[model samples]
Target chain A: MPQGQPEVVPDDGLTTRQRRNRPLLAVHTGSMKGKSTAAFGMALRAWNQGWSIGVFQFVKSAKWRVGEEAAFRALGESGAGGPVEWHKMGEGWSWSRKRGTEEDHAANAREGWAEIARRLAAERHDFYVLDEFTYPLHWGWLDVSEVVRTLRERPGRQHVVITGRYAPEELLDAADLVAELTKVKHPMDAGQKGQRGIEW
Target chain B: MPQGQPEVVPDDGLTTRQRRNRPLLAVHTGSMKGKSTAAFGMALRAWNQGWSIGVFQFVKSAKWRVGEEAAFRALGESGAGGPVEWHKMGEGWSWSRKRGTEEDHAANAREGWAEIARRLAAERHDFYVLDEFTYPLHWGWLDVSEVVRTLRERPGRQHVVITGRYAPEELLDAADLVAELTKVKHPMDAGQKGQRGIEW
Candidate 1:
């Protein structure tokens, strides 16, 4: 809660402790960087608290493994903290099928949404990261209204974080927390290129 | 690069390969959450890459140790990756002095900035997190122009990430990458209390 936090009363009729324990729907969207990075940061926080983590990447290739994915996957497999289940479009969402066109990508996005909707209904994980999920709604591959409804009605104390640029209005309306990252400047503007450790 | 990456040519005439190796001055600011969290997330990335990390917090009291500090400190002390030196205003910046009233806090912030300026001049760490550094500048406790000049002319390829709301224009102008986080919705607005794992 930084600035202009709306005055909210106890509308849910829950005790403070109970309300603190409730699940959260968080959206990270905008033109600047770190939307997915912030979502993954929350996942790291949640995982450290022994919460089961589920990560679903919508756009990145299966071969494109970011460092967070590697660290979380390794930490999850360490048999010390909560286990993590990671899925990507080419891998779990599309059943390892090759996709080269917009149509196939749209279909996979839909498939991914369907699976996530089912998991939300089932309350499979304590924390769910829908990394770069806004693109499908922005692209009209998934119905924004339906996505909002499903997330708003998601079951149990499962926290879900969706990240991408151009997040739909309906989704924002339904989210419990929303961060719109605006760009004030960028390294590329200065002709400085991105490196693997810092950029990825 | 996400949406609307500025079309920038290499005005410095450096090769893309050469530009890729240069470190950056990143700023996360505005009236929203995830500013510091995003900076900490980058620290995680840097830790994984074996880059020595230094985190300096200005506004938050030293008693308030966030989860990232714990994790990074643990990783740093484990004799793995690179070292982490975390300093808050109350700890390293206050010169072991008792703090009371806003004047003392302001003085501590100024002292903290002086130490960090020296560190930046010395190129002590590969990656630096100036958490909540903008508040002092916004409050006129620190000179924004001096901060910008020092950061712009800091020695070595050490990447610096500064986080806070209402970052001064001069700092943003000097930054290599800037993210302005905008508030859309917040749990505090819904009267949902913050818990340790999620909020910290």
Candidate 2:
């Protein structure tokens, strides 16, 4: 009332401070050997704890691949409280020789990552996982420092898990815990073909 | 007279020869910074050369944010020609607040990655970018050595790109090109908020 524009009254009555209670958990794996399975189990456990969760696939192009989407569907169908929203990379893979232009690819990647960041901010998930995030960093499609900064800046007590082969030392330093996977043998080495359900 | 189980027929009409094409140009950006954007641009450039491309987001959980998915979609729509398929991580981020009987997270991660590997094997792409592949290695979800061997053993002249923050030095040594995105300045420091379609 004193000023030309009435001072905007802070809606303290309507505003309820959101309690940041979740922990940021980074799960960095060495290889793809058993990552999917392990990730799934951990997600289920968290879901059982009544934690709202968000799932994301960092670098995947195929619609039919039964990795992230399948797991969510199965869990939701198996009585998980809510369905896990799935997001897939539209560009199947960026290594095609027929690509049109660099700007096009950069724009695409930027859009894809922007979408992911938006969801992370909007949703009130207790846990957020950045899957195969290393690819973007490795390919130079995403800025690693920016990503790390985003992770560090994400508000709330949300636990973030990053799965991939190599986690930057900086990320590891920032992480509360770090685990490494080493492979001694695999069926492929014995000339056996990958099996569905078991392998896939 | 035919021998038991049909005499092993050695193909005389067809000559078994390998094509000596340029080795698949694979780039891995371990440091974060702008690696994702760089990878996307590089991939798009490679695509313009009329080479079939495959992009794999090794970690499936990190891309859940809306910003991340939108980036990929934009890329696909930007006349890159052909669809960019994304393999999503259905399970939310993997973290064990409480331990259980089974190795759930590991199992889920493995399944998703196996699916990706299967697709890579079946599809014929000129370039394959494995995004955020390092998490699997750090988490003990996948086999590092085995993955390296498989990548080395892949057929065709397909180029591979692996991006992550902490790529093993061994991988860097083996790679044809290795880049690290170092962090210098970030918007977070300036108090600039993450804008939609800008920072994902």
lDDT of each residue in B1-200, candidate 2, tens digit only: 00112123333343222211334434435333344444543444344343455555555445322333333343344443334444434333223223233346566556656655665577566666566666666676788777676676666566676766666655665564454443333333322233222223
lDDT of 2 by residue, A6-40 (tens): 12433334321221122445555565243433344
Interface RMSD values for all candidates: 3.9, 19.5
lDDT per residue, candidate 1, A1-200, as tens digits? 21223357676678777877888888998887788888877776677677889999986566443666666766676555568888888554533444444447787888888888988899889999998889889989898888888888877899989998888888888888998878777777776656767866
Residue pairs clashing in model 1 are: none
For model 1 the TM-score comes to 0.85
Task: Give the runs in model 2 whose Cα sits over 4 Å from its true position.
Answer: A1-22, A63-68, A77-79, A90-106, B1-200
Give the number of the best model, judged by lDDT.
1
What is the C-alpha lDDT profile of model 1 across B1-200, one tens digit per residue?
31223367666777777788887889998877788888877777787777889988885555443556655655676554668888887554544455443447777887888888888888889999998888899999898888888888888889999998888888887878888788877888777766766876
Report the lDDT of model 2 for residue B78: 44
What value of lDDT does candidate 1 attain over all alpha carbons?
0.77
